[model samples]
Structures are given as structure tokens and as C-alpha cells.
Target: MTSKFYEDTKVIVKDKLFEHGWGILKDLYLGETPLASIAQKSFETATGTKLATVYLLDLFKENIVAIHGEYQSQATNVLSTCNVFIKENSTANEVSNCVDDFLKNANHYIDESFSRRLFLKYGY
Candidate 1:
């Protein structure tokens, strides 16, 4: 069964990351830019804030790890695929393709009986 929370989080993260444009998307997947930076940028862009609080940053970091763990649990091949994209000198198109495949194969379900988490932790 698909999880509404997981699906919602996925859409939210993707939309936020792509909000300004697709310019940073490749940088993120390539490891040239960190997800934290993107998260902060997204927050600032959405809220017009000059700075994000440490609490928000910590929450984002924690939820990001939790979300990754959930994704890994749902798709066993996710880490290996991500490793390939990150560790290898893959072209932009190759990385995009790999990410697309990974997303396509992921099972968007959460163990709802346990902690119900979202990537950003709070809505923008």
C-alpha cells in the first residue's frame, strides 16, 4: 500500500528543490551541492527570510536521514544505485536517468504504525 505521507513528502521535497529552477538539481545529485543548502534555499525562497533557525536546520537534517532510511527500507537497491551516482563520475544525463529509475522503483509506503515523518518536518 502506498503511503499518503511518503507521497506527500516526496512531492513537497521535489517541488521545493525545483522551485527556482532545475539548475541546482544536477548539482545536488552530483554531490557538488549539499541537500542542506537546498533546504535552506527553499525555506528562504518560500518565506523570504534571510536566515533559517538552527532548530529548523536540525529538523530538516534529521527528517532527511529518516526519509532516506524509509526509502532504503522500501527499496533495497536504492543505496547501491545512489552510491553509483554519487561515487562515480557520471554525466548529468546519466545521473538524471539513474535518479529517475530509482524513483520509479521505490515503494512509496511508510511503516505508519511507527514514527510518521516528513522530509521537511514542517510545511513551507
Candidate 2:
């Protein structure tokens, strides 16, 4: 079953993100958002990691994704970190940056993963 955040909230965010013309971004998300993780070629997952979120904007009708957080295992750098609460009243710019950063991170991970495979198969 999909999370309620996914069913009800993606549209609002997709619209907002699109309207703002954000190519990709990382923004404040409530503690509960329907998001997925964009795994690295050799990525890992665990509890408390805010991965990436897949979005389909209304206007574009194409899916995009945004990611944040990091991977840490066996007590690595990210294992003990906490989600920085986007300030209760953050400025518009701060929020925008977060969203943008997230999108860029997600896209980079995704693009790199697919491109390598495509190149291997077809020599791009």
C-alpha cells in the first residue's frame, strides 16, 4: 500500500515545485512524506534515512525525483546523524535550496547509474 502522503501530497508539491520552475531541489518536508530512496550503484538502506522522492508534475506529466540524506553502515558518518528539522519558519529561499539540492542529488545518482549501464551495453 502506498503511503497517504504519496496519494494526497505529491500533487501539491509537484505543482509547487513546477510552478517555481525548480529544475531540481530539496525542500522542507514534514517528518512523514511519501518518498523513496535513489540507490547508488552499490547503495544501502536502513531505518531513519530520508532517501529520495519520485514526483510527476501535473504540467510536465513526466516523473522526476529528489533525494537527501546519506548512506552509512556499520557506524559510518551518516549512521548517527539526525534529520535537521527545517526551521519551523524557514525563509522561502532556504526551502527552495533544500528542494533543489535534493533533486540534483537524486538526478545525479539516477543519471550516473543508467548511463553507465547504457554505455556498457551500447558504448555511448
Candidate 3:
């Protein structure tokens, strides 16, 4: 998939899994979780194509499992930045812009990581 499409699919799958409380399960452990099924369905729905189960699982691992910690770190950084802006009495617009920029960067990071992992694993 193209980077843009993969990134969009990641957002959809992430939202769907989170809606089903996948984050809590992820924090606990891994292996045959229902989130995999949810992720597969979400991907098919978003992309109009059904990938093999193994491929789907790999995609899930790359998109969610592998990057969970980094995602959390980015989230923390954005929150800290917002807090700093608040403490400095920065304008609301400044805080909003910071958050927007962080989100854009975070999405780029996810896309880049996903592409890198796929290339390393499959040599695409």
C-alpha cells in the first residue's frame, strides 16, 4: 500500500481497536487477542480488500504492538508541551497549533515506521 493509504488505515484500525478496549488488552499481554479480528475487519472496511490472516497480524503488530511505546512517548511529549505553554500563559491558539503540529508529526512517524518495518521484513 502507498504510505498515505497505510497511514489512513492505521488511524481507522487504531480507532476501532481503541473503541473495543484493545489498548487495555495490549498493555496486559499479547497473543490471539480479539483485537486482531477487529483490526482485520477494520482494515478490510477501510481499504476494501481482505488480507491474509498472517499478513493482517503482521500489520497489526507493526502498527500497534511495535509502536505502542513510541506512540505513548509522543503523546506524553505533546501533553508536556501543552502544559509548558499553559504555564507560560501562551495563547490558546499557540497551544492548539502545537498540538496540531505534534499530531502531524506523530502520524508521519507512524507511517515512516510502518514502511520501514515492512521493507525490512518483506524487502519491498
Candidate 4:
């Protein structure tokens, strides 16, 4: 059985990321323990914002990952939104940089992870 999130959401490709455009990016789990650890660290070291959403995409083929979140602090009444898109082959450092860049440029915020799930399960 494939994970619920994978079954429902389409894989995020480079074209889709381009379609979303760029903005400020503000951006886990167990037994998941090691995978979750890498994922959590990837986001934690990359951006200065709270992680609000996560998505694992391009499964089997590329294992692409994307995230959406907001900056940790804001003085205004409105909060800035951030989006990050990582290629399937990105290294740990690259993942961090990709996220950091996204948050720095994000301007608006919207809900994109309605179908996203925190757990990942795969079985034969």
C-alpha cells in the first residue's frame, strides 16, 4: 500500500514549481525516524520560519519534496507566506538553501497542503 498523501497528491515537478512563481518561503515524523530526522533537519537548518506544511513528491522517480510555511516573527497584522521546492537529487545543504531562499522571497500565503499527510507508509 502506498501512503495516503502519495495516493492523492500529484508529483510536484519542475514545471509546477515554475508555475507557482517565487516568493518568501517560511517553512516531520518517525520510523520514519531516520527519514523524518533528515526531513526535519533539512527544514530546520534551512529557514527561519515555522514549518506549517510538508509534501513528499516525485516518488519512485525522483523523490522531490516541497514545503510551505510562514516567518517566525512579524510586526504587522498580516503574516508573510513562504514556499520551497527541492529537486529529487538535492543534497542536505542544497535542501536547506532552497528552503531559505524561498522564505526570503515569499510575499503571499495560501493553503496548499490540504491533502498533505505527516506519515509515510509503503508496503507490499
Best by TM-score: 2
Query: What ranges in model 3 sit over 4 Å off?
Result: 1-69, 72-87, 115-124
Model 2 scores worst on lDDT over the 10 consecutive residues at: 57-66
lDDT per residue for candidate 3 within 24-98, as digits (tens), equals 223111553323222221112121322211111223323321122122222232122221111123344543453
Q: Which candidate should be chosen as best, given lDDT against the real structure? A: 2
**Candidate 1 lDDT tens digits, 1-124:** 2233323443444453344332222213235323322222211222232221110011332232122211222323222322112212334454345445433333222212112123224333
Candidates 2 and 4 compared: the better one by TM-score is 2
Error of 1 at 80 (Å): 10
lDDT of 2 by residue, 11-100 (tens): 343444465443333433436432333222233222222233333221212222222344333334232222222332445465456556
Say what the RMSD of model 1 is.
15.0
Ranking by lDDT: 2, 4, 3, 1
Per-candidate clashes, comma-separated: 0, 8, 0, 11
Please give, for residues 30-52, the per-residue lDDT of candidate 4 as tens digits: 33321211121111212222343
**Which ten-residue region of model 4 has the weakest summed lDDT?**
115-124
In model 4, state the lDDT of residue 70.
36
The regions of model 1 sitting more than 4 angstroms off are 1-85, 108-124
In candidate 3 the C-alpha lDDT for residue 47 amounts to: 19
Global Cα RMSD, each model: 15.0, 12.5, 15.6, 15.7
Q: Per-prediction TM-score, please?
A: 0.26, 0.34, 0.28, 0.30
Question: Of the candidates numbered 1 and 4, which has the greater TM-score value?
Answer: 4
